[model samples]
Target: MFFLKDLPTRQMLQTYHERYPGMNAEAVAEALRLLRRGSLLMRALEAYFTAHTLSQTRFLVLIVIDREPGQEGLLASAIADRLDISRPVVTETVKALVQAGLLGSVPAPGDGRAKRLTLTLAGRAVLADLLPGYFALIADFMAREGDGTA
Candidate 1:
């Protein structure tokens, strides 16, 4: 007795099962749910970053530099690798952050072709101000989900 709202997904699940007898409908449903939840969280975070005049990419770059050990800036390539982002995107974001006075860069020691990036005072301040609220949002979301209220 499938409800009307469940008919479409149930049909899709049946179709998948027919095409691939080993398909696990439950796993597929769970994966889809996880993706949807991730999308929603990203959208919310994007809006929050926008309010601070920052893009998610830029925020990510800032945090990477901020978390660097000993506050020693990291090369652009290192940032890209650590964040699993493309080099071009990291380069562009770094350039923007530098222009905004949220990041500072210097030539990497013994690497004439490489530049190291570090978070500026302003960047640290911005992250410090926003992190508490960001963490609280995550905690609240987790609590609601745990209680089946989200």
Candidate 2:
């Protein structure tokens, strides 16, 4: 969330360069512009996820499972690791997903205490329904970037 709507002006950055030796005004300005664009993209994604009744993490969890080599799913631990998030966070989200009938857990083979998480029919349908809008959002954003509007 780079929330600085008004990025520093070139003149301001040039003034900063005078006060701070070795400061690159052009580089700094370019970096800020990139950050602002990234922030815009993230905000768009956040809004999209919210409309879908999901957070970024929740969306990612579903993606991680869907992207696995087989239609078969991964363990909660594996998902957490892949997402670089904590176990409890993954567990909590998974619990909610399961409760919503979007996910299912079965006892892990050869590991009675562990569970493997899989997408339910509803989950697959949700992804099928949701991805077009998601991809379109991405394409729209990238198109704007390509047009130098970002």
Candidate closest to the true structure, highest lDDT:
2
- For residues 78-149, could you state the per-residue lDDT of candidate 1 as single tens digits? 898889789899888899999999888999889899998888899899889888977887787666556322
Deviating ranges (above 4 Å) for candidate 1: 1-8, 145-150
Model 1: lowest-lDDT 10 consecutive positions: 1-10
Clashing pairs in 2: none
In model 2, what lDDT does residue 89 have?
96
TM-scores for every candidate against the unseen true structure:
0.85, 0.88
Number of colliding residue pairs in model 2: 0
Candidate 2 per-residue C-alpha lDDT over 2-115 given as tens digits, one digit per residue, 9 for 90 to 100: 889999877889889999979888788888888888999999999998998877788888889998998668999899889989999999999999998989999889988789
| Residue pairs with backbone atoms closer than 3 Å in model 1 (clashes) | none
The TM-score of predicted model 2 comes to 0.88
Q: How much lDDT does each candidate structure score? A: 0.80, 0.88
Q: How far out, in Å, is residue 111 in model 2? A: 2.5
Show how many residue pairs clash in every candidate, following the order shown: 0, 0
